[model samples]
Target: MSRTRIVVVGDVLLDRDVEGTVDRVTPDAPAPVLDVTGVHASPGGAGLAALLAAGDGADVTLVAPIANDPDGRLLTEQVEVAAQVVPLGHAGRTRTKMRVRSGGHTLVRLDDGGPGTPTTVPGDVVAELVDAADVVLVSDYGGGVTRDAELRARLTPVAGRVVWDPHPRGAPPVPGVRLATPNVAEARAALEAHGRHADGCGGPAGPERVAARLRSAWGCAALAVTAGAAGAYLADGGQVRFAPTPGRADGDPCGAGDRFAVSAALALARGAGAAEAVEQAVVDATGWVRAGGTAALHHRPGPGTPRPPGRAGESLEALAARLRARGGRLVATGGCFDLLHAGHVAMLQTARTLGGSLVVLLNSDASVRALKGPDRPVQHAADRARVLRALGCVDEVVVFDGPDPAAALARLRPDVWVKGGDYDTSALPERFVVEGHGGSVVLLPYVPGQSTTAILARSATGPRPDLEVLR
Candidate 1:
């Protein structure tokens, strides 16, 4: 399947986190002295939204204004690897938000640069990108990107779904936007700005009323008002639905809006309805928060690492604990994968689309020999694992030594267990194990004529060269 093309156009900024430890009181003042330990930098605003979309396996393009400064250069370098970044040069310094933290708690936040006008991308360039998009996300961070009339006009006629994450200082979206996501504070502020009597929180006019009013005001097809801890209230047409969050999320709420917007946009790009998209976004955002929110961003390893961000080979118990803390869907599939083929790729990619992460359980050499006879497993377990790690669809790979994956399933406790359509639930020995953990088993479509057995058979009929496979 072709990847979904997403275009994110809005404000971009740089975020820096300075972490340290408070050791003693300062001699100059009575404040505690912080011994600096580490510093981390990442993209914020539309840049982050694009990164999130790209992380979800979408073809993303970010169009935003960046100043010609140190912070701007850093933001550009960081975001360019994640997506196709198109920079519109601005005159002022790029916005930078610095947070000082100690022992996982923020001491103070300092803001530098900002409240400045963002440079507008050329009209033709904006139109060209938006025209080819599967979904357009407008991340208005109270910056001047959305204030450009020409850009807004170009987005008005987009054939794809348009999702607007509104900011009070930013301009409203064009008419006919598909969805609008705003938190309770932003919703109340917007309503009050429009001369409407809106109670910010727990007011006589609840979130349902606030959502309805915002939907009409923005001329959007649907509106979702997010109330932290209380979930979100979605309003479409005359009907309103409340989708409560799974549990209370603990962590910084800074990037929650960006995560929510990108997830919803990706869902829409995949052809999900408005309500379903909003619900999925809520789930993703909730998981993001529970995983330490912005704190998780700093845990990534530096360059030249052997394994990718989520591809490390860990014990089943360790992996399960990490996934639970992360609070997203965990998908697992087991197979020999003796000779990685298109069918295997398709199954893995399909499994990834079913959840936030995909874990592949490979049959160890001993197990494959037991299952497929002595002449099976064209490739060794190590070689097979190396190849699987190269695929973008696979998040992690584990080799299990058993005829059935019941033991692995019991330890991992994955949320979903996937298999090819060729097999039925009753035929799978691990089906009961998965269901016992409150997980579902999914049978994905199988690609015919794309099996390793057929390839090996054809090879045997042809000239048999040295088949000294690596052990």
Candidate 2:
């Protein structure tokens, strides 16, 4: 199969991170002293988007202004490891952002260097690169590259294949661009820049309104307003769709926007529609955050790295203890997964994201009969556990005997208790047990018009030949 060629255009920056630990306070001042442990440097801005695309196994080329300074050289070398660089020439010093962190938390960030405006744009070379690219992602970082007349001219012609990840100080997306991804705050600011009031964009439909207005204003074919952990809202012509995140992930989200833009560009290049691309991007971005965001890139688990229990033969208690020891939250959700349809899969997938690992408290055959009636549990407990464990999102499945999973939940003691929104949390017997132990309960939206009971009824009346009769 031919590789997807992705070209990233915009400004680049050098990112430096200083990791250390804080202990005793200085004698002269009240400030705590940090004994530095390590220092890491990498590319930021558009260069980050290029690296992300390249990491996804795409053929990536980054087109940006690069200075000959020390920081610029460092940024280019790191970026070049993952992508080819087409320097547009820089008029000023290379920009840099340095963050000091201790105990996985940032103490402070120091930004230095220059405005980093592009001095030269070889039109022919840029045109050639754009023409050859399957997708062009403009990752604007409020720098002068996106505003350059020569760069804009080259981008306008291929706007149909362009995905613009916008910045407040950067140029707006060229007309007819495929997609523009802006975080909710940036979207509001963009509207305000156009003499439109952002106050009108609020409530449950806030993101949808922002996306539609931005798409029309920027002249892009579609716009997706990302809301971080809440996922994104896409506006494609007259249609609007909200792609909610599966669940909350606890990790650094520094380069998640870059991750999102790269995923969307790759999806569109693979022939996915704008809405479909945004949906896939949301999932990809969430996973990036779950894996410790951009910081995880520096400290990836090697071949010999010990992994948490997702493999077979791991006990539920062992998995829970390991996750807790690593400061990872344990999420638990219970259900009588008799049929295991699309709805069940969706719910399970969402629950898994609520924490580091997911433990499914599956109802026993006897439990299902008591709660769902004698005709329930078409599949036996063993078969149900096998299917649940087979799901990539599910960590472990524990069969518990009872009408409710209250007794089992007391033993599991997950950090988060998840359930479908169809049920009332106040009425759930397991709620007290979960909250009493300092665990929180979350109710996720259920897929509309999908239920095991309904499926069984349909099966009894006129079962599809493709389906097996469990009874």
Assess each prediction's global lDDT (C-alpha) against the native.
0.80, 0.83
Sum up the clashes in candidate 2: 0
Candidate 2, residues 1-471: lDDT per residue as tens digits? Answer: 999999999889888889887888999998879999999877889988887787777999999999998888888887877779998888778888898987667789998877888998999999999999999999999878889999999999999999999999998888999999999999999988987766653443377887888888888899999999888999998988999875554456888898889899999999999988998888778666655565555553342221211111234444465346445689999888898888888988998887888888989999999998878779999788767766778766678887788887887789999998578888999999999999999998878878898888886799666565663
Global Cα RMSD, each model: 14.7, 10.4
Indicate the residue-level lDDT of 246 in model 2.
Answer: 53
Q: Over the stretch 1-471, how does candidate 1's per-residue lDDT look in tens digits?
A: 999999999888788899887889989989888899999888888988887787778898998888888888888888777788888756488888899987667889998886546555688998999999999999998778778877888899982378999998988778888888999889888888877778646555788889999888878898899887667899989988988765455445678888888888889889898899888888777666645565566565553221112212235765555555445699999899999989999999989888877788999999999999999788899779768866777766778998988998999999999998677688788999999989999998879888888889978797435554532
Clashes (backbone N, CA, C under 3 Å), per candidate, total 0, 0
> In candidate 1, which residue pairs clash?
none
Candidate 2: residue 30 lDDT (0-100): 89
Q: Candidate 1 — what's its lDDT? A: 0.80
Best by TM-score: 2
Collision pairs in model 2: none
* Alpha carbon deviation, residue 195, candidate 1 (Å): 2.0
